[model samples]
Target: MDATELQAISDTLMRIVTPDMTPKQLIKAARKEHPNASKRDIARAAFFSIIANADQDHGKAKNLQAFAIAERTQNGAE
Candidate 1:
């Protein structure tokens, strides 16, 4: 995805994510505003968001990174 799409997904994730939210919940929530986003796209956005958000919320950024890795590897995604 392009930077604009990534930014949009990142923005949506920032708005929708919560401490209690699951990976599936995160993806679903993000997709509501950006239905064309793939798991890879969301994962990229999550990683992108991490750099910008780590200082303010390390745990949230870590969770998002973990979710991104999971999305990339789960069920033999490759």
Candidate 2:
């Protein structure tokens, strides 16, 4: 996807996710919100969102990064 599409997906994921959520929970929530999106796409958007927010929210970034890693691992894409 292009930068703008990626940003939009990231924004959507950020709105749906919380720091307390696990990787499965995050992916489930993302898939619920974006039923047509591929799992890899959602994971990529989530990763971008985590990095984008890292400067302002390190704790959240860490949690979300963990979720992304778990998602990647579960999908055998890591």
Q: Which of the numbered candidates is closest to the native, going by highest TM-score?
A: 1
**For residues 1-78, what per-residue lDDT tens digits would candidate 2 score against the true structure?**
778877887877767667678766776787776677787887898799888988887776777788778878988954
lDDT by residue (12-33, candidate 1, tens digit) is 7777778788889999888889
Q: Can you list the residue pairs that collide in candidate 1?
A: none
Question: Each model's TM-score, in the order given?
Answer: 0.83, 0.75
> Residue 23 CA error for candidate 1 (Å)?
1.3
- The superposed Cα distance between candidate 2 and the true structure at residue 18, in angstroms, equals 1.9
Q: lDDT, candidate 1, residue 39?
A: 76
lDDT of each: 0.84, 0.78
Please count the clashing residue pairs in each candidate, in the order shown.
Answer: 0, 0
